[model samples]
Target chain A: MKLKLTTLALGAVMAAGPVMADLVFPSLSYRTGPYAAGGIPFADGYADYFTLLNERDGGIGGVMTKLIECETGYNTEKGVECYESTKGEGALVYQPLSTGITYQLIPKVTADNIPLHTMGYGRTSAANGEVFSNVFNYPANYWNGASGVVNYLLESNGGDLKGKKIALVYHNSAYGKEPIRTLEELSAKHGFELMALPVDHPGQEQKSQWLQIRRERPDFVTMWGWGVMNQVAIQEAANIRFPMENFIGVWWSGAEHDVMSAGDAADGYKALTFHNVGRDFPVFHHIQKYVVDTGKAAGAGDQIGTVLYNRGMYAAMLAAEAAKTAQGIHGTADINAAMMRDGMEALEINEAKMADLGMPNFGPSFNVSCENHGGPGLVGVTQWDASSKTWSLISDFKPTDGDVIGALVAEDSGAYAAENKITPNCN
Target chain B: MPDQFLFATEVFINGLMAGVLYALVALGFVLIYKASGIFNYAQGVMALFAAMTLVGIMNGQVPFSHIINAVFGTEIHHFGWHVPAFLAIILTVGVMVGFAWLVQRLVMRHLVGQEPIILFMATIGLAYFLEGVSDLMWGSEIKKLDVGLPQGGSFWIEDMTAGLGSENFYGFFIDNLDMVATIVAALLVVGLVLFSQYTKQGRAMRAVADDHQAALSVGISLNFIWVLVWSVAGFVALVAGIMWGTKSGVQFSLSLIALKALPVLMLGGFTSIPGAIVGGLIIGVGEKMFEFWIGPLVGGATENWFAYVLALLFLVFRPQGLFGEKIIERV
Candidate 1:
């Protein structure tokens, strides 16, 4: 109890003051824990992008964006405390990095009338803006990622997934299990045998899991792992000599930090991604000049080119763009969290906008609508070439089967709305 | 062997391999509990620190870069020279020894006469301190530590065992890293036993374990013995760190494996080395077999808690653990 209170007080100290001049974007960060391998890069990228905006463009719409990182260490309780402490400080939006935290924040943010950008993670049904009201998982969600992985597999096997055996070895938590429903739906739709294998939390010991896979002989293994789990899974996959080509991971498991441990053995491992990897984009040049070269970067500036780093930057860019849109809509420089929520509802990042933002086709361009907070659920596939030690985008961004996923989203969100006595508030 | 039996044998072999890794951690706990009568909860965190330090040294990363960066607003990452694996390990060992000395001087020495529970809590405090220090120093990014340890599955073993199962079963899939770990663990146990049985310092350690008060009466320095055992435990942690760090990249979850060792310690007596080893093997094999056979019926993923449950059951029957001396209540 003392520790919790102390952490809350510490979170208060770290939060941006409830000042009018700065747009406080409280980052629920975890730069010191099990998932720090992932969280550090993401937090760095998120902070650095805001730093870049402040330096390069003088903030979004002439208002300073204070990206105060409240260290939660990926603990859900700490995350909730961080939310409660910082929501008073004009927090424009919340990006609870962990899905577990996102789950906890969804209701809280709704009550607080603040917007949350879960971004490619969190509850897939939260994409239904009509029910969630304040929660947003724009660009893509886990359902999109799952469908994308299946779509890639179907395309790889000449568009027919009949009589195929696919296994999902996922982390046994909310974040890891987020895609089960979608995968199950896709399997039934495509006539594939879906075997769900839940790896225990942290997922280091998977000798028995692979043994079962060896016995069952699943044609393709789709991993939804994170942290040390990713490396361990890759190592175990390599140990089982599961064809690297046949095994794929979600975007969370696709980073260099995960596969580098396996070295050459992880050569042909593929993963589903919504954005392009590498430091070739124009925005990266600006980030290098404005953040890294200026020596004001949060983490090792040289690590700017990794997969998750890019994703983090993309998330920050989206948030900033939403803030800009809110400013434009409200016709005020100092827009509040409510206005920011409105701006998030009106977010649109097309090719022209991406180019204007100095990132030309860096990722799949999508728009968030009033009823659909999740943009056109588009995702691409990337393969890791250990020889070159880089990820290359292998396919065009394909839209998820929204006809199927949309129905599930509506059903799930309807259930949530009924449970919470929340009337659909679409405008 | 029939296909079903062959698969079970394969699972058992994998379990034994995992047990060796667990024993490596529990061995450190037993060493400390025996010598100082303090349950070092920070033992796992010690392994994380050792691995982080080793990786930091090898990569030539600037220590405390996070703090240094936060204070100065500078983005310096590396000193830019890769030290060889052998040299890095040696330097890391030096750091661990220095850490042991520091703990003795600062934390452990102050709480020298504290109750066992108090000392245990202090170690937990030490664990958090070391974790923060490690994160700040290494910059919290997971670094792949490759000390040139052999990895992946052994083709030789796989090919040799192919005919043991049905055509569908493509032999056993044991990690070659696990194989290397088993050999290293065997060597470590032997070295520890030989040193304790033969060397004067080791004899002093054994004496301290026997009775700290009696050893002190017979001209042994309790502080010196405590320091020596801690130093030995640090060495054991480093070896475990290297094995685990190489298997899965050195990250914070590397510390949680210490939790796994707790059940092993409970099943084995806290003061018994051989008991730690046997208890680790039993927990490992038991969990794996249970998960493989009964896990599916209960929705799988049983490896996480099965060991703890088994350990609890073991304690109900044998309170002093399998190889531990029978405990007698003073009342």
Candidate 2:
């Protein structure tokens, strides 16, 4: 009887062993509350991608990967609470998703020695790895998006925007305000007239702003909006008969839901992006077969090919690659948060690696180093085909004006370093 | 006319249309507050719930499919049959009426004799509860709501007024949706006025609003009247929801439109329906004008707070609002 009890105890312990995962990636997701529409698919994609890796390749570096999702509701306080509560779970990295939460977590992650991947959103200056040692916004950042819009316009306008008028309808928050400074500098360089229009949070009411747009009649209108604001602005633009082709939004504003409500009126609307959209890649088939078909999707299995889903999957793929790099660097499958940070700093993404992972030309091929955590800030443009309900990349992931971005990054990061009393050294 | 004057004229016209939309939301709040001395904080959530229900019914989405799938490991999403917009709307009204009855039985009955603050707090609780329930029922994804309402710019108006302004001005830009909202709001107001003046239940509601004790003494069932008023408010919310949801896709942010209605309520007086209309129009026009003329001087986005400042000034100068009942004391 004692031997039988011993065997039972061992079985119980083995049953609980999978609960303590080898690698933990805490997803600060906002699957509830005001931003849930955007948050749901992204969270689903993030979790499903990791599930795919585990089901297909037995996780990163032959050890199983675990994703711990905590709902933040896109609120800063809730995001911080989620981070604090989940940081003790041996969290390898955090993708807070919200720029407000990113600002709050930058110092916290640095203090805790956990790597933070803000992706396309967050403080653009965090690109300076010398000042922000733990935070990584690789592949592309917001400055690149702003410059990318200008470059696309320049190409369309026959390489001259000297006399063109551009209006920026931006969310009156840090995330929306991010592109203004860069756009201002670019406007000065390219000699295009720039007008700034601020839309408050939860921007449901915008009669005055749209009326102003209708009155002023800017040659081009670029929006830095998200959530309900994106749909509302697009509808209002359609209402004012704003030429949909001339209106461009950042990646956050260019999702399936944003233009679906406006129907065919939103056709030809443009948006800047950092990654390829649609489910044409081979990885999605594996995800469908392994994760979704097995009834293990993080959300409804319907979110497979959406823009936000693809972006979320891309984020997870980058995280997994960084983990693989970490394992290669330390020569061990078992690594910690500090090792993850080092791995993120030394990571690289080339075309061959992307194709090997079945995500060829999925994103720009960029490298992260000790001094540059943001990679070469390459950006592309995508236009919506309302009839097909799809977003196709219209421009290649081309180079942004590096000289201007470098100067702005140096100025912003230098100020940040002075404020925090941190030495500007990659070491 | 000069280009600047024509632009201001266009802003004014748009502001009036925007006010009508705000007033539509305020009408729901006014009805509840006038009948029961309780300020219904859940008015916005009611609109959100109604919109979600309408969309869910129209799309043939299985309610709580997300939860069901999660618990039972099922893959159910839709019923594979779409309900027409008219039938879906009728079904939604029935659901909202049922909801009204439930609220009266489960919530308002328990707090019948409570203080106004207590009743208001209960509504605050109801708001959150309803929001969660709506999310569970419809799933929180942003769904497109189309009841065949007109959208896009009114090219007729643009063409008619194209010659009124300078060459740069492309005529007064007006949305077709806003024009429909104006006509619908006018008809609603007229219908409400005739109902309260002619119908027996409407008279009972007004009597209850005047003196609850007196109305009870006259053999009026307070519970029935409360449910009736709530049902009417629910219908109003549905209309508001359809208008706003059709403009901006049905989502959680639809609940925040109640914040915009608060200034309208304060300016128009919580007990008066006509006051709600006038207040909505004034607040809308004032904010738009201020944002246009003065927002550029300051930073833009003054529309969010400008209404409150105008309402505050009204409060300081005339506490009872434009059409609110004037209080008197016998002491």
lDDT by residue (A308-395, candidate 2, tens digit) is 9998999999999999999999998888899999889989999999999989989999899988988998999999998889999999
Highest TM-score: which candidate? Answer: 2
Instruction: Give me the runs in candidate 1 sitting further than 4 Å from their true place.
Output: A1-17, B65-81
The 10-residue segment of model 1 chain B with minimum total lDDT is B320-329
User: What lDDT score belongs to each candidate, Candidate 1 first?
Assistant: 0.89, 0.92
True contacts kept of 1: 0.85
Residues B36-98 of candidate 2 have per-residue lDDT tens digits of 988999999999999999999999999999899789977788999999999999999999999
Off by over 4 Å in 2: A1-21, B70-74, B328-331
Cα error, residue A34 of model 2, in Å, equals 1.7
Q: Provide the lDDT at A8 for model 1.
A: 95
lDDT of 1 by residue, A1-427 (tens): 9999999998887774577889899888988779888998888889999999999888888878898789898899999999998898889999988999999999899998999999889988999998999999988899999999888898889999999999999999999988999889899999999998889878877877888988888999999998999999998888788899999999999999899988899999999888888998888889999998887888768778899899888899999999999999999999999999999999888999999888887877888888989999899988999999999999888998897799899999999999999999886
